[model samples]
Target: MMEEILYLGNIIFFIFLWRIILQVLLSVIQIFLKKDRSSTGDEYHRLYEESIEWMRQESRKSHRR
Candidate 1:
């Protein structure tokens, strides 16, 4: 029974370690894929404005009696 418990502990430790390593690797890859913000800032702002306008319209519709 003791041996089984030790083996299970080792397995869990390695699985957790593997998850941490994978997350670090994915974060590094995302950094490479991310875009520079200088060119796209205006487009992002426009989309944000449209989203806020849509939300206001929806709230106004819901508040009507």
Candidate 2:
């Protein structure tokens, strides 16, 4: 019946709404508690150094031009 279909739709909607709320809350908590670990990694450090070297080279080239 139409009423049963409406009830099922409401149930599905509420379940979806609850999932979204929980995801938001958990993400907020993680943002407050989490620190970025990439900067601490060796790969990140190497990349940062490479970027700095590239910038210095570019500046030198621009100064010569």
Candidate 3:
């Protein structure tokens, strides 16, 4: 009976350790994904600003004509 208890305890300990490892991996993946999304958003915002400026310049030229 004592041996059986020891075996069960070892199994439980291993399972707990495995869960902790998986949590750490998932956290790292989430951080990486957030960084990737922010970079893409920054690029899109810069392009939008440039297009708005171009439109304003064209409007001014049209008014001069």
Candidate 4:
């Protein structure tokens, strides 16, 4: 019957919505815990900048040779 089909559809929609909400909640919890694992902060960025600068210097030296 149409009524039964509508009820089933509603249940399916609710399940899907709940799953999406739980996934978002889990992701937030994971991100909160992930930050505790590292204390490096902006050090990785500084290292990257230093490496790039070194590469630029090497490139310039090679171009002159």
The TM-scores, one per candidate, come to 0.52, 0.52, 0.78, 0.55
lDDT of 2 at 1: 100
Model 2 score (lDDT): 0.89
Local distance difference test, per candidate?
0.89, 0.89, 0.98, 0.90
Best by TM-score: 3
Error of 3 at 10 (Å): 1.7
Cα RMSD of all models vs. native, in order, equals 11.1, 8.0, 1.6, 7.3
- Writing each residue's lDDT as its tens digit, candidate 3 over 1-65 gives 99999999999999999999999999999999999999999999999999999999999999999
For model 4, what is the error of residue 5's alpha carbon versus the real structure, in angstroms, after optimal superposition?
0.5
The total number of steric clashes, by the backbone 3 Å criterion, in model 1 comes to 0
Q: Candidate 1 or 3, higher lDDT?
A: 3
Cα deviation of 19, candidate 1, in Å = 0.3
Q: How well does candidate 1 match the true structure in TM-score terms?
A: 0.52
Model 1 Cα lDDT, one tens digit per residue, 1-65? 99999999999999999999999999987776565454477789999999999999999999995
lDDT score at residue 3, model 2, on the 0-100 scale = 100
For model 2, state the Cα shift of residue 6 in Å: 0.2
Model 4 RMSD, rounded to 1 decimal: 7.3
Ten contiguous residues minimizing lDDT sum, candidate 4: 36-45
* Candidate 3 lDDT for residue 48: 96
